[model samples]
Target: MSSTISDPASDGVVRAADGTPLKQRLNRALRREKLRSFLLILPLLAFIVLSFIMPIADMLFRSVENQIVEETIPLTVVALKEWDPASGEAPGEEVFAAFHADFVQAFKDKKHTRLGLRLNYDEPGMSGLFRKTGRPSTKMQPPYKEAFIKVDEDWGTVETWAVIKQASPAYTDGYFLNAVDAHRTAKGIEMVPENERIYLFLFGRTMFLSIVITMSCLLLGYPIAFLLASLPLRSSNMLMILVLLPFWTSLLVRTSAWKVLLQQQGVVNDFLVWIGLVNDADRLIMINNQFGTIVAMTHILLPFMILPLFSVMKTISPNYVRAAKSLGANDWTAFWKVYFPQSIPGIGAGAILVFILSIGYYITPELVGGTSGIFISNRIAYHISTSLNWGLAAALGTILLALVMLLFYVYDKIVGIDNVKLG
Candidate 1:
C-alpha cells in the first residue's frame, strides 16, 4: 500500500493508488467524461440534423437547380450555344437537326412533356408546341427546319430557341429571379409585367400584417397580463384557465367557429342588427378578408403574448411601484416608469413569438384570408402541392427563412436578445 514508483514524471507529482501519475489519470478521466457527455447528446444532434438541417439543405439546393432542360436535350443545348439570339431568325438547319435527335429520343422516353413544362415557364407556348410535335417529330426528315415549321410555326421563331438556350444550364438563378417576380430572358434580368408582379407585394403584406397582429396581441394582452399578475392566487389561477381554454380546442375548430361568428348572416351580424349599429340588410362583410384574418389570428395568438407578459410581470415586485409612489411620483408615473419598464423584456419576447408565428401561418390565412389577404406562404404551398414546382417553392421558402433571420438579427442588434425574458 505504501509502494511508490521512482518514475521521473512522478518525482514531485501525486500518483494514483495504482502508481500512475495523478495528472495523467485526471486527463484520461476528463476525456472519458467529455465523451460520455457527447454520447448523451448524440441522439438529439442526430434528430436535429435529420429533421431540420437536411431538409433546409435540400431546399437550398433545389432553389437554383435547373437540370431538366439540359438533361432532356443535351445535343440541342450544345448546338444552340453558338447560335445568336439577336439574329432575328430561327437557328440554322444543323441546330434543328441536333434538336431533332433530342426531340425524337425525348419523345420515345415520354420526357418531352416534362421538358416542355420546364421551358413553358419561361415561354408559355412551348408546352403545347412540344406536346403537339411529340408524335410528328419522329417522322421528320433530315430537313428538320422546314418540317418543324410545317408542323408548327413556333419552331421557326427565334424566341423558341432563345428560351431553350437560356434554360440550357444545369443550374440557374431562374427560380430565385421568379421568386422576386422577375425573370431571366435572352436579354438580361428584368421585372415581370406589372400585372404579373405578385411575390414582392405578398412579401410586404405578410410582414405588415404580421406586425399588425403582433401589436394587436400586445395591446389586448398587456392589461390582461397585468390583471393576472396582480390578482389573488385562486382568482388568477381561475382566470388563467380561461386564457388557456382555446389551447384545448382544435385550431381548425376555432377557426371554423370564427367563420360562423363573422360571416354576413352569422351571430356577430345578428347581434349588431339587434343593437341597431347598422341596418339588417347592410350586414358587415368580414369572414373572408384581411379583417377576418387579423381578428382570428389575434385571438389565437393572444395567449402567446399574455403568457410571457404574465410570467415576467409576476416576477416584478409590487414594492418597486410603491417605493416610487412613496418618493412623490404619481400612480401613473410610478407604474409607467418602474413596472412597465421592468416588463419590456416580456413584451419583446412575446412580440417576437407572435410575429414569427403570424408570418409563417398558412392554414388560418388560407381559411379566412381570401384572394386579397393570403400570405406568401399560401403561394408557396400552392406551388408545392398544386403546381408541383418544387424549385420555385424552395426559392420562396428560402427567401422567407432569410427574411425571418434578417429580422431576428435586426431585433437582436436593436433590443439585445439577451434582455428578453420569458419568465
Candidate 2:
C-alpha cells in the first residue's frame, strides 16, 4: 500500500503507440515542418539572392578585380618583376622585348589602348604612349629598347615602367584608394594634390546633405503623422489620401516640377518677390545648389517618414497619455515623458527609411544639385558612363554601401533596432 506507482517514461524511453520513440517521432515531424517552411520561402530567398545579393557582390568584386593589365601583358609583368624601379632607369632589352612581343597584337586587337587608358588613370601619358607605339612597335628589331626610346622618350623613363609594374597585379586596391582621394605611385600610397581631392569633398557633402534631408523629413513628418493618428477613422482615411498622392505621379515629373518652382525666376522666387520678402533683382539662388537639393528631397521623402510614424502612432493607446494626465502630469510633461518615448520606434523606422533612400538617391540630387550639391553617386555615374572607369565607380559604390551599413550599426547601437517598429 505504501509503495509508489512506477512513473511512465521513468526510464527515459518514451514510445508512441506504434512502438516508435516519441522523441524520434517528434524530431522527424520537426524536420518535415522545417523542410516545408523552407520550401515556402525558397522563391523569396532565390529572388533576393539573384536580384540583390548577386549584383552587389559583383559590384564589390569589381572594386578590386583589376586583371586587364595583367592579362594584356603577362610577359612584361614577368620581365619587370626582376627589374628594380629604384635604379632611375627603364628596364633593359629583356623587358622591352617582352612588351613588344605582346604589344603588336594587343594594339591591333585594340586591347593595348584599353589597357593604356586604364593605366593612364594612374600614369597620365600611358594611353598616348601605347597608341603612338602600336604599329611602329611592331617594326622594332632585337634592340627593342633603343628603337622604342627613339619613338617616345617616355618609354625609357623609370616612372613609366614603374607605373606599368604597379598596375600589373590581377587584383589591386588602387581603385578604392583613389575613391578616397589617394593614389598608388612609386612613393606607395599618397594623398592626391589638394585641387584633385574632390571625392572626399563629395563624400562629405553627400553625408551632410543626407543628414539634413533626414532631419527635415522627421521634423515635417512628425506633426502630420500625429495629426493623422489623432483624427477619427473617417477623417484620417481621407487625409491619408493626400499623403499618398505623390506616389501616383512620376518621380522625374516631381523633381522637374521642383526645378521649375525653385528656379530664380520660377514660381517660388516670383512669389517671394511679389510678397516683397526678397528683392526681384537679388532672387535666391535656389536651383542647382544645396538648398534646392535639400528642399526637393525633403518634400519627396516626407511621405515615407509620415507613413511609418502614422502606423506606429496609430497603435499607441491614447489611454496611456490620459492616465498620465490624470496622475497630475501636465500636457507637455506627459507628452515628453510618455508619448514621445512610445513614438520613438516610429521615429527610428522612418528615419532609417528616409536616410537610406536619400543617401543613395542620384536622380533628384542630379537634377537639383549642381556642382556644389552633387553627391558621390553623381561621380560614380560619371565614371561609369563617361570615363568607363567601372573600377572606380564600383569602389565608390562599395564605400557608400559600407558607410550606410556603418550608420545603421550606429543607429542600432544608440536606439536599439529591436525597438524600431512601424506599428
By lDDT, the best candidate is 1
Error of 1 at 275 (Å): 2.2
Worst 10 residues of 2 by lDDT: 1-10
Give a tens-digit lDDT track for model 1, residues 1-423: 223644455347777778788889999999999999999999999999999999999999999999898889899999998899988888999999999999999999999999898888787888999999999999999798999999999888888888898898999898899999999877789999999999999999999999999999999999999999999999999999988887566889989999999999999999999999979989999988999999999999998899988988999999999999999999999989999999998898789878878899999999999987799999999999998888999999999998788778866865577866532
TM-score of each: 0.92, 0.90
**Candidate 2: tens digits of C-alpha lDDT, residues 193-274:** 9998989988888889999999999999999999999999999999888888875568898899999999998999999999
Q: Name the weakest run of 10 consecutive residues (lDDT summed) in model 1.
A: 1-10
- Scored by Cα lDDT, where does model 1 land? 0.90
True-structure RMSD, every candidate: 3.2, 3.3
lDDT of each candidate versus the true structure: 0.90, 0.89
Count of backbone collisions in candidate 1:
0
Candidate 1 off by > 4 Å: 1-10, 408-423
